[model samples]
Target: MYEDHARIPPPPDGGYNLNALKPGNIRHYDYWPEPPGPQTFGNTQVIFSDHEKHMVARIRQADAVFGCMAWLTNYAILDALAGLEAVQIVVQKEDFLRPDGPGWRKTKLLRAYKALDKNLMRFNIPWDVGSCDQCGDPSIEGVRCMGVHNSGRKSASPRMHHKFLVFCHLADGYPEPYAVWTGSFNATWNGTRCRENSMYIESEPIASAYAQEYGTVAALSEPLDWQYAWVAPEWRIGS
Candidate 1:
């Protein structure tokens, strides 16, 4: 949708600004600029009838956002998530983190968050570990297998796959969600590469519910605390 991280469409912008007005059929803005406490602004004839003129206000009101994906491999997405305020992040990834990994498996989440602002903190959860012998143990898989385990220590799941984003449009000083984005787009290059679609839901109850789910997953993302050692037990004592 956007040409860059700024979320700006390509120049010579044609067609309507999809998000100029919040989705979910929300025709008016609950929070207004004047002193009448939004009554004057919420007037059906004044706001709804002429909403196209209020595009600036709608864009400024956006703050809260959400994204869920089967596998997040996009750097731009990662940087944006890390910079968002008061965000709880949850994502499943297909690749493993290795210091010596190739291009595909080199997306280090912790590093991504830390690189943003040094103080920026985000709960980056990985796919939940599957029930198997290798749940926590760090034994080598095979000659070609990489040692680094997936986040949440979960084995990769090829079946359960879904991608979505929820954004809470909060006005200055207001700490609540007013908009949300969700869909099957992986929030990565997959969004543009594959046949995917997304919908923007602009309702507090709906947005809040999805946001809560992200919080729940963040809390339950405790991975196994096992370390990986090299293959072939080298049992050399104090020799």
Candidate 2:
């Protein structure tokens, strides 16, 4: 649990903006409100580094977790999450690299992917790379470009536009139990930089639903279809 670490650490540069969405509050950067000195609201904490930082810290405190992100560009964040008991991450297909062109763009993208491959192989974590030609239903699984080719309505730029985490919280008295955390944030800097919201809920029904969805997405993944520049040895393409 988070009993040892300081859950309420110091705030980020701009601090927490409790009301960033009120009226035109989030519109202009210069007009953003400053923390009227150190602030606290009950036990609620705000991490200013973007949603991924909060997620990494939270996952570190959990017994286990399942994660799904549309974009996977942050190696530092992924490296932290690799220490978790369990992890499942689904990202865009290798085509995401095409947009980066060559040189440093491609090199950096491959480096980040190699980090993912290392975590999956070394820790035996469940992670896949996927992307579709077009977008699909946000409510359903396999919206990412790697979505199982929908023989029905194939298109380009199918995006996995969801960001969610399911975990079992560890406690002193009760058994580690299931909980869900989801939001409009990716595991990237854009998640924290852009205005986004995340929801944390713990319920058997909700957990079960998301867990099943995670499985569905994994099943739809074609690991051998698209290969990263630096792929795990165990993931060598199958004939």
What do the candidate models score in CA lDDT, each in turn?
0.38, 0.48
In terms of TM-score, how similar is model 1 to the real structure?
A: 0.44
Local accuracy of candidate 2 as per-residue lDDT tens digits, 1-239? 22222223335774543323333323233243542321234333333324665667777777655555667666667666556544456664555444345688667755554444322221122222222212322121212223422234457545545577667653542223366667666676545556666655656667657766664555454442344333222222111
**Model 1 lDDT, residue 194, Cα:** 42
lDDT of 2: 0.48
| Highest-scoring model, lDDT | 2
User: Model 1 over residues 108-202: C-alpha lDDT tens digits?
Assistant: 64456334332212212111211112323322110011122344655752322434445664445233655555555554543444434444555
In angstroms, the error of model 1 at 138 is 27
Tell me how many residue pairs clash in candidate 1.
11
Please give the lDDT score for candidate 1: 0.38
Best by TM-score: 2
